[model samples]
Target: MDRPRCVWVRKADARVPGKLPIVYSKSYAVRFHGLERLHPFNAAKGKHIYKALCAEFSLAEGSFYEPEELTKHQLRRIHTRQYLRSLRWSLNVARIAEVSLMAFVPNNYLNHFYLRPMRFQAAGSILAGKLALDYGWAINLGGGFHHCCSNRGGGFCAYADISLLIVRLFDQEQCRVRRIMIVDLDAHQGNGHERDFSNWDTVYILDIYNALIYPRDNVAKLSIRSGAELPNHTEDATYLRQLGRCLMQSLAAFRPDVVIYNAGTDILKGDPLGNMDITAEGVIERDRLVFSTFRGLGIPVVMLLSGGYTKASARVITDSIVNLRQHGLLDLSPL
Candidate 1:
């Protein structure tokens, strides 16, 4: 297979010494005459997180790496051509975005306002994955569309970004990274990647999600190496304990070259969609635990901001990232 001309594959422009491997772009924000506001998924989630990280780190916008929009040719590496064609219809995009009103919008307008932003985020995921090999850690302020797979999309996910990232690395960096593990801490089960990687031994999935939520795909559960299904309103103590045990077990069972951390803030208390009760401190500690565990072992980690709703999600994520820096898990200084 011919490699797609992706920005991540180009090294000189990919990273700078001492700079954090944080991928983002203004194109990640979806805007369609304010119609995005009706959707529960924050249309500007990446933009908000980017601003917060800039303030917290006292960094200029140039400190971050920006990815270009993913072309259809690049998307075809994993997604089916028919599935890609379906997105050209407004009704299909409306269903994927969970915004029923978008059905009436013109497909061209939706392509510009919604799909274009998704393409940028999808490219960011691929960039962050490649950066992790160089920096030992990287974060994409956007991405983690875990509900969309190679041929299907749902739960406000229009692209299979996580799958794309995994495929890109496995294809381009096979010598360095033969095995990949997905640690999906999103409130919803990451059915997308699970379905895509099903029966593939190289990819190990460890998902912790509310069993009662949307896209309860029992079929996809077959791909998960370790999984914890939680009930509604489950608290942080229980969530974290299960997570710790699962992490240890997963590590013992299968060692991975890189870990994909889908850190979703939807588990926060009172989230309309997540339906869990994890506190802000709990979420911060959760991030610290994941980072310390992997980074301490010299394993590379690439983080993606997944399904977080509510206005406070951005603050919670920003705080969690700061806590990781304080713990020294984000240090990229040369020895």
Candidate 2:
């Protein structure tokens, strides 16, 4: 069997400085611990994890290929023009106001600056998807901003990267490929994805999440709900079993042409944001199941590291990437 080709996209600017003040009053300090206020920690931890994985796998250090800037015309394919314009203005105004009418602007002046990079990040994922069609696999180490909607942003996500990419692919007359399966294991419901792609027959989404968490409404509203919306404090074995079953069912039904995976590490035990309890080994096993399952079905996969919090959580995610590389789940052949 031939090895699959993987594209790793990481931009240094993607790591921006915190300009928003921590809102201490949003949630109860006891249960929530104001951890959500520590928004930059996850991104920092992700950088550490990526570095460790590169060293461990002896993978060549590669910079992200620059992608074309997302134009207003391109964004209009998925987002309403009015909404797009509003976001543009809100980003500029968000630096002064802690909150905006339709969206939360933690930092008024820096909103646009903080989110501006998502255009490139999203373009990278789109490129990765296209590359996967030829390479059999591609890994986008950063992306998976699944909580952002066409008109709203929340949950630390500012742009709907994969959704926009899917829309763009559909609009291109020459891109004949159809039937995309989005496998979201981010420990949170793929609200943004489900909302955008629900009516599109060619796109099928399988999202696994902790039921008792933020964005709870998303699980109930999935067009094709396949996985258990497990409760908080669920053990590792139970979660993995359910995930395996869901993957099997999705494979049998969708028989998709391509797989887009949101490999989030928040399910790890003691994750700052996640409520579930999964071990590092458990995360690796979950990755193996999803990647190997898609490969066995003869569908190419493009993986994006979605959401992971805490220091060790990133290490667990990095381990999964390394495992994929070692087992040839990710293509390493010279391009």
Candidate 3:
């Protein structure tokens, strides 16, 4: 296989004159004979967000950049061969997807119905990373599979897209992104990238997650340079306060060439899995604060929609993106 670096060596401009740097594709919606309804995660979340953004922004269908699916060779840049091989087994994919019935299905069917969408979403993340550098900011309507590391997959996260994005940028000479910060505001700790970058000083992780949630990896906590362990049912004020403190502290401790914001809406009240009580408005403000802090300082940001489990997640994310635009954080015009 050719080196992955060669794929990104062109450094072509990733922007059109008036379009937003949002990455998405129709393949991002995972559908499989109504089997997706068995899980709480909205399989069509990205499609919903895409439609809403187009309507709100008066964008045409082609306004957003649609990313192609990631090939196995591209995935090899970060994923282990064994891990990728494991994905070929329907039982293993069923475990990662948390849908027990998928274990009985054929691997080929599962690959096309489920894993293929994930690969496209992963590609969207890498594309968004490159776009962020050119446009000062970018958002992949899907991605933030933060539970999968280089060798394992779980928590409905089958791809280490966050690690892939960072690695791709570091490999490209023209990107010049030496230092990267991961602001994982998802309700669950981002153990995947944490594990991948544990010993890398150039990558700083600031994670604020519910302490009593799933995949409570104590070892991953050590990788977080600045972190907050929020209790179950934590509300807006407390969550926002801790986020502000961590953001300021992270900024003081280390400067970054780029910031990847995992803006998960699972913290919204009534979310079955997240167990947090933050409101939709709180989510909007959370995004605004993060975007303003980084964009105000002229730091490029790549936003990814992470582990939001409820049907309302898409609307909240759409509203948050609109709010960011209203706050002028998403303006792509010349500075």
Candidate 4:
């Protein structure tokens, strides 16, 4: 078959200041302060690599699409009215507590207020879902804000964009999608997503992450094995083998109408936040296993660049997009 339609939302405004802004510090918190700055680079870098790959592979860029905007009512479908109101209110509130300023807060408070990347991030996913219905494949350059919940925001996410998009699409009866699968491969477990979708039957989440380290409570109590605590420093082969089996089993059982892939590069061994040791080549293989399997099943897949902390992590993101392009997976048109 021909290449699937790939949709990427590239908005320059979504970039945020790093978590720890101090240039130097004596504590671990200080060293990790600048983590949020990595998002823009992580998001932008992937497109750079994908474009290069498109040139090298002679892929047709016409198959790609970029969206324009996402409406607030669409966001309200997944988020509480009070939460959305609070976010807008917080944007104008003066003397807000330092602790209350989170990653999901408007960009103005963070110094790059003019960019407003969060709006684009939310809009991008909505666009990806719409395009996925039309072309059978799509991608959003910045997304995977799984930590944001229905009413509150934790982690670096401002809104639970993916969940809201899914809800809106279902409510509108857009494309007759009945069942959807979310495959989260970020280094951190999607704790917020698990909580939000726990009661929903139509959505199934398959998350893979290191057991130990950040977000200590990643795996559900029922899913944990006796010795599964602290899965840091795991061997690449072992991780891949286990992940492959899980993917196969989940796909077979759920047989979803659409699949959302959170391609996080933080699983690399040297990733500042990630404790795992997956190599560049290993990351490529992981993408292949997931994308190829879905392609074989004729299931439409939407891709998102989730998380990556290492300075050199851009290469892994680039490589994954390149592989997707070569396999006729990505639509490489200009945004």
Q: Estimate TM-scores for all models.
A: 0.95, 0.79, 0.95, 0.74
Global lDDT scores for all candidate models: 0.90, 0.65, 0.91, 0.61
Check candidate 4 and list the clashing pairs.
13-115, 14-117, 20-33, 61-332, 61-333, 104-158, 108-113, 212-230, 212-231, 269-277
Model 3 has an lDDT value of: 0.91
Instruction: Please give, for residues 32-138, the per-residue lDDT of candidate 1 as tens digits.
Output: 88898899988877888889888988886588888888998999999999999999999999999989999999999999999999999999999999888888999
Candidate RMSDs in Å, in order, are 3.5, 9.3, 3.3, 9.9
lDDT tens per residue, model 3, 1-335: 11223333556676777677999999998889999999888998999999998899878778888899999999999999999999999999999999999999999999999999999999999999988988899999999999999999999999999999988888774335878999999999999999999878889999999999988999988899998999999999999999999999999999989999999899999999999999998999999999999988989999999989888899999999988988888875632
Model 4 alpha-carbon miss at residue 210, Å: 1.3
What is candidate 2's local distance difference test score?
Answer: 0.65
lDDT of 3 at 95: 98
Question: What lDDT score goes with residue 76 in model 4?
Answer: 76
Q: How many residue pairs clash in all the candidates, one count each?
A: 0, 9, 0, 10
* Descending-TM-score candidate ranking: 3, 1, 2, 4
Ten consecutive residues with minimal summed lDDT in candidate 1? 1-10
Top candidate by lDDT: 3
